[model samples]
Target: MSAAAEDEREEQYAFPMPPAGGWTADDLDRIPGLPPHTELIDGGLFFMSPQTDFHMATLRLLEFALVSAAPEDLYVVREMTTKLAKRDRPEPDLMVVPRKARTSREQTWYDPSDIILAVEIISDDSVERDREIKPRKYAGARIPHFWRVEKSNGLPVVYVYELDPATHTYAITGIHHDRLKLAVPFPLDIDLTEI
Candidate 1:
């Protein structure tokens, strides 16, 4: 293109693309709190899609199961923004921090190393992000286990991710059916029907 054409084209798109920058932990502090189940993405804050009755029920049931299987000492945080780095603190649906780390009073943020497992419940708003995006970030941090729940197909599917001893990245171990009859993550062995 000619110089004049190039200049005109550049002028036509003078405005910058939005959500343009990475978000830092300090930026997380600056943003106002949103209502429950909401999250920050890119550099903007937005609510996680309104949850369905089944979704809420599922989460509640899972919480109860975890509480029963695991002792009270393991601090479980719901919807907490774990400070992983200057730019990322994933609020996994459920995370269990070691009892000692949880008791530590010198911390300004939750350390990634303290987290044993990270769980995410996927809705329409988070399917792609939970499945495709979070693994890369979480695996990079060497989180031992990750779980994903989705109801998109009208079936309560579960995906379990674990780190292979030989590889740091996560690989799927098993996929569970929607039925409330199976249990794999030990101690969490209560039947789905029981929940």
Candidate 2:
């Protein structure tokens, strides 16, 4: 492309570039009505497509179960953004957080330390990202627990992991198909097929 055309194209794009230092979590507030599925990773925005009915169904069921099992001081939320760093904010499919930490309804994202558990329900479009990139980011942020849900033969398979602070990675705790029971982040028991 010619320099003039390139300049014209750039001018037509109204969105301003991030400052030299990069974007911070505070920058997200400036974007009015940001889509619930949008996430910020290392200063770039990634938009996830709408989930399938089965995926949503699984997520809602899991959220309900977690909330029911959670203690009064802790609760579960769906698609809440977590501020992992100045340039990284990820919206896990569901999260369990302390009620005290979530008292500030004005905040767009929660601090990673406030999050006790992060869950992701995978679909065709997000299989690799949910399985790989997100776990690394969540573990690096020191979130204590992570759960990934995968569908196998039309059943939900739950993969649970706990952070290993020594290595700053996650260690597999358990994988459940028919039922899920975990002691950490409080005792959670859920029937996979119920969803």
How accurate locally, in lDDT, is each candidate?
Answer: 0.67, 0.85
Q: After superposition, how far is residue 48 of candidate 2 from its true place, in Å?
A: 2.2
Model 1 scores a C-alpha lDDT of 0.67
Write the residue-wise lDDT of candidate 1 on 138-182 in tens digits.
Answer: 787777878888764454566788876577789988776644322
Clashing pairs in 2: none
In angstroms, the error of model 1 at 95 is 0.6
Instruction: For residues 1-195, write the lDDT of model 2, one tens digit per residue.
Output: 999999999877546567778767767778655555678877887677878877988988898888888999997878878988888888899998888887667756778988899999887877777899889999999999999999988889999999998999999988999899878889878889987
Instruction: Name the top TM-score candidate.
Output: 2
Residue 192 lDDT (model 2) = 90
